[model samples]
Target chain A: MSGRHSKHDLETTPDDKLLRKLEAKWEDSPTRVLRWHKGLDVRGLDCNSAPGWDGDKDDGGALVAAHAEELSELQERLFADGRSGGSRSVLLVLQGLDTSGKGGIVRHVVGLVDPQGVQHRAFGVPTAEEASHGYLWRIRNALPRPGYIGVFDRSHYEQVLVVRVEGLEPEETWRAHYDEINAFEAEVAAAGTTIVKVALIVSKDEQKARLTERLERPDKYWKYNPGDLTTRARFGDYLDAYQELFEKTSTDVAPWHVVPADKKWYSRLAVTELLLGALRSLDLGWPPADFDVEEQQRLLAET
Target chain B: MSGRHSKHDLETTPDDKLLRKLEAKWEDSPTRVLRWHKGLDVRGLDCNSAPGWDGDKDDGGALVAAHAEELSELQERLFADGRSGGSRSVLLVLQGLDTSGKGGIVRHVVGLVDPQGVQHRAFGVPTAEEASHGYLWRIRNALPRPGYIGVFDRSHYEQVLVVRVEGLEPEETWRAHYDEINAFEAEVAAAGTTIVKVALIVSKDEQKARLTERLERPDKYWKYNPGDLTTRARFGDYLDAYQELFEKTSTDVAPWHVVPADKKWYSRLAVTELLLGALRSLDLGWPPADFDVEEQQRLLAET
Candidate 1:
């Protein structure tokens, strides 16, 4: 209402100019959001890079708030579209090393929309049952049904990432998973799920600081996994695994986004904006009402 | 402890004689269980017939009890075996006309196992999303994960059965589904899932009687779907649909069993026995312990 457009116009617009404006500002902002393309040389990419948000914690809060209303309304349209024969949905696959503020992204970014609209699955060590199926089997089951946004805290990448670094399976076994995973993602996309995968890149110094803080604070102990240090010690191997992961899996259908996550607010805002872009790309509209609206209006007025 | 042989012996036996003995009694019993084989014509099959249970309600109760303990034990072992790495499971696909006692079989037959070990998905009208994918997409999502007994209240056969009878889609569409379903089941079976399908056959009069009873009782109103009567009106079309369903979709990986379901008690027992036979065929053994037993025992004793 305050700008050239009305509130309704903002809500219904396919690609709202406001969203594009905010995104443009984000492009030049201190905190950097990395978009993965085919044949990305992840080795050259620096984990410490932020879009360059060197401001205080409160920085970018106003921009996130500006887009919040549109984001919320767009999420509803996405849900409604899916329910009404659209049969389409979004899956945000979040993967990163420990203490990369994965939880913050979930809490601050995704938390803006209706909770019921989001399906969250946290992948842990595979159950003997899950392990029995090809690694991607449980993934298929956890996929969001139509009319919902699905978030994977960690995903099938474990087959390549942790499994590779830990030497849990023979190199021959885990190595083949990259292609299988690519094919699987391709199939899932072909079946109508738009996949937006994000890797939260945190610097080693930043990770050390977060882990040390967890140790010092009793409140954060529950979030702490001692295994994180073990994983961190093999950071080079893990980084190489991720490099291969990006190179191999960043397909046209489901591309991976690598965002520097040293700043929690910047990362959260980036993810929120990333999801906004994904949802907007669907060009979702409100579903038509099933019942006779005129008759319902008459009945309600009479009652 | 009271049995003549040890419990371990019975569990370890490839095919227990006692189970076979009970199964043998079932073969000659008045209430007959339908076993479909290659080239068997389903048209000749009698819906009104049941394995004769001349005795009162208590007649087969003892036999059911006899197997209950072992069945329960075997189910736990199946769960444990899967947890250890076997990744095996059984899917009981139940199909039949209205008032065919699919619910009763779910309750009385499948109810014998631990609730945690059973994955029951009662499919209803397909969501727009489900229809967008091939008919089997939702079915795949509903499949039993490893280490569980999965039950389909009604299944993909509806595409060939109800969808066919009602002309919900073109003849070309429903006709192509049978081969697709067969190939799908074959893959599911090859993936370590043992599929057992049963259609509880109740005659027209029996369905009529059940529907009337539901109409007369206020308590049973919830179970009554008026659409069931409409479905009953087109019985011949449905019957022809089934005959085609049996002829096409039944494969080595998953087969259809047409059982006499006029008698709930007898049919329930027959289905229970059918499932038991399927599970026993897997020749499951308890998964070995993960820890060193003697050392753990010594540590506990010392403590």
Candidate 2:
């Protein structure tokens, strides 16, 4: 694995190095992924451009529009194969802070797949009946069948993110979930399910602007919760809690991709690439017909 | 209302009569709709087609491919709008019997929508926990948010379809869900969610060929369950069950469009039109920004 990494880590390969650099830079700051994981002050990032930014908004929009089409096409092909073949499944889990754009990401990424083959489950406040069961039960039921793709707007990671952030559960209970999630995902992957985990990262200022926008916009007023303001105020604590989460749970089976969500288009592009990249790795294809073609043709003609 | 009907029915201009005839001819057979509502009996469908019936096989393939590309491009536009605006949501529900081409319709229809705006939920047997709650609870929770689109492979209608068919619930419980569903969908629509419901109707002979192919193909073995045969054998009971469902549940609020699934391409085409039609009705646009053209021009000059 290290040798494989070294091959891709060629000095002349600027793209690989740039990606590595971005990942490292994100790792150092750490706060973005943390805010996403801890669920303490989950604020959505501003996707719109900043005033006086260097980029031309038209060009930026065009680039995003093109990429969106590519990703959308890839998702459609993958979905068609999955629905028809019935051999494999895919699960995309998004964990992000309040307004971290988990919903946004899902709206964009899973939206590309066929509604027949893809399933989306948003884990909110557990119902009394759901709460009665073990923590992972509801999550388990939401898993897609063979040949389907399931997207979790918020997922089993909540046991670690929210329960731990609010101290709603004992230390041991939340801690146990990291292993449990990894195990559950492993089982899923082993059953031909591809799991992609993403944490939508937003900066404090970006979040503040979004929350303010939400309050001002009449159409968006429905999404603004009064409690969210208090959550936003404790931003630093949320950061720390999330940083701890990323370090512990990011694993080989289901690696966490920290999406730079301040640029919503960029975030959507990255997530789309991540998913398409995963599907490409699967080498999916239409299943071959079983019987002899000529014989079947002859038989049908006789009938 | 009767006068309006009489104008089209008894005394119409030639153009109007042609239009009415066209509409009536295109309207799906109630029996075809029932075949989908009840699981399909694939063994019954006639498998007698001349050489090369598969759409992917010839000159017909070229035409279909071109048509698909056009649909795909339209879908690309929808996705761009969905990601940017994120204001209105769409829900497409596909309900059909085994081999009725629910998956096929999903593949084809979803092939047309922007992946960023659509969420697909495939509802199956409820777990003990899910069953404990009202049947529609899990389905409702999976509804798409504002500016998103949700597609359900099997939906809340299962309360009427499966529960009623299997005698899992009393007549009153399953029967009343028709009104309950209408109310539920109305609420979602009021909340900016557009519901597009489709029942894929495949001929009995087309179904038989599909089942035989499923049995013969190793890769398709996963889709072939022992229960499907038992269900297929009881086709008449299922048809009666579904015809009643369609008659009672099809309403102006969220009318059920029956797609001809005998031809996979036709099914895809019909569903794609129905879905795109619903989205088209939304009249979505980019959020208006307070942009000053002259000020922005000066800003660009400075850059």
Best model number under TM-score: 2
Q: Taking the tens digit of each residue's C-alpha lDDT, what string does model 2 give over A1-303? A: 012233224464654554444334322322223223433332343334231123343433443444444444444445545546555767888877777787666655666555555666778889999999998899989897665667888888778777877888999988888788778778877878778777777777677767766555533444555566556666666766666667677666677766656777666656665676666666654345434545543443343
Output the chain A TM-score of model 2: 0.75
Structural similarity to truth (TM-score) of each candidate: 0.49, 0.55
Where does model 1 exceed 4 Å of error? Answer: A1-303, B1-24, B28-33, B38-44, B52-57
Clashes in predicted model 2: 21
RMSD of each: 16.6, 12.5
Candidate 2 Cα outliers beyond 4 Å, as residue runs: A1-87, A183-187, B1-303
Model 2 has a DockQ score of 0.14
lDDT of 2 by residue, B1-303 (tens): 011232325666764554344334334532233223333333343323211122332433333333343344334334444444554677888877889888766655564444544566678789898988987789878897665657788888878776778798899878888888888888877776777777665565666688777666544644555466556655666666766777777766677765556667556645655664665566653343333434433432332
